[model samples]
Target: MTETLTTALIEMREDDVLAAVRAATEAGTSPAGIIAGLQAGMKTIGDKYEAGEYFLSELIMSAEIFKRALAELGLDQSAAGTGTRGTVILGTVHTDIHDIGKNIVASVLSANGFKVVDLGVDVPAQRFLDAARENDARVIGLSCLLTTAFPAMRETIATFAAAGLRDQVSIIIGGGPVNADLALQLGADGAGISAQEAVILAAKAVEGGVA
Candidate 1:
C-alpha cells in the first residue's frame, strides 16, 4: 500500500501530503517512486469519480493539492518536451475553465516521461493550432469539463482539418464530461479514461498509430 503519500493525496490533506513527501525524500525514496505514489492516489481519485463517490469539487481539491505537492517536490509542470517518451499538447477546451481532470492527467503524463505542452484552462481552438505548429506536436490532447465545450471540440478538430493537419496530428479528447462516444463523435483519435491511458494514447499518437 502506497498510502503514505497516496492517502494524503486521496484525502486532499495538503499539509499531510507535503509532510509525507518530505519524509519519503529523506528516507531515500526516488523521485519517480514519490511521483508514482501521487499518481496512484490520482488513479484512486479518478476511480472514485467514476464510482460517484467523489464529485467535481473533490476532484478540484485533489488536483490543487496534487499540483502543490508536485511543486513542493520541485517537479516543474511547465517544463514541456522534457521527456523521452514523446510530446503531447494538452489543455482544457474553450468554455471549460474547470481543469481538475486536466491537472491530474498533466502530472501523470509528466511523471511517465511525456513532454506536455499544457495550455491551461479556457483555451481557444486556434490556440491549439498555434501551439501545435510552434511545438510541432504530433499528439494533440483536448480536455473538456463542460458539456458546452463540445462545440468547441468540433471547431478545434475542424480547425486542424481546415489547416490540412488533421491526418498528421492525432487528437485526443478527455476530462470529466468526456467519454468514448463523445470522443468518436468529435472524430478524436481516442478518449483518455485515465492519466495512464492518456500516456498510452500520446505515445501511440506520436507515431501516427491512433485509429
Candidate 2:
C-alpha cells in the first residue's frame, strides 16, 4: 500500500494517489506512515525537477497531488498537529506572489513533524515577524521567485533583527533566484535548493544546530 502510494505520487497520478491513500488508510496505515510515503514520493519529484527530468508545471502538479493525498488522509496541510516537532513560519516575500515552491516546502515540513505557519504569498516583512512571534516559530522560510524580491527578503530578515529575534530563530531562504551566497548576503542562516533540503534545514534549525 505504501509502495502504491509512493509510486502513484512519483508518477504524478493524482487520482491514483488519492485512491492509494484511501486504501492505505483503510488497511490500517497510520497517518504518519502515509505522510512518510508521500514525502518519499515528493523527494523523488524534487530530485527529478532538479535533474531537469521535470519542469515547473510538473512540480506544481506533484505538489497538488500531494495535497490531495494528504487531504484524503485527513491531515491538515496548513499547520502542524499536537505531535509537531517544531514550528516554522513560511512565506514568499512582499511583491513575490509565487508560492508553488513554498507550498511544497510547507507540506514536506508538516509531513516531517514540523508545525508550519504558512503566511501565504506576497507577504510583508512585518507579517513574517508577527507570525513568527505569535507561533513561537524557531525557523523562518523566505521564498521569492523574482530577483527584485531580494530586497524584500532582506527587509524581512532585518525586521527580525529589529525585533531582537534574530538570535532566537533560524532563517532560511529559497526560490529560483536565491542561493547560498545570496542567502548569506541577505543575512539568512542558509538556503535550500529544494523542498527536501528545506525540511532538513528546518529540522536542524529546530535543534539549534543551524549556524
* lDDT of candidate 2 at residue 152, scale 0 to 100: 95
- Name the best candidate (by lDDT): 2
Instruction: Point out the worst 10-residue segment of candidate 2 by lDDT.
Output: 75-84
Tens digits of per-residue lDDT for model 2, 76-177: 665314226688899999999999889878866665567788899999999999998898888999999999999999999999999999999999999998
Candidate 1, 1-211: lDDT as tens digits: 2477999888888899989988888888877777778778867876787678886566667767766767777876444223666778889888889887887787666654577889999899999999999988888999987789999999999999999999888899998778899888989889997765786778777655663
How badly does each model clash, as a count of residue pairs?
0, 0
Give the Å shift of residue 202 in candidate 1.
Answer: 1.1
In model 2, which runs have C-alpha deviations exceeding 4 angstroms? 43-58, 78-85, 95-114, 145-148, 194-196
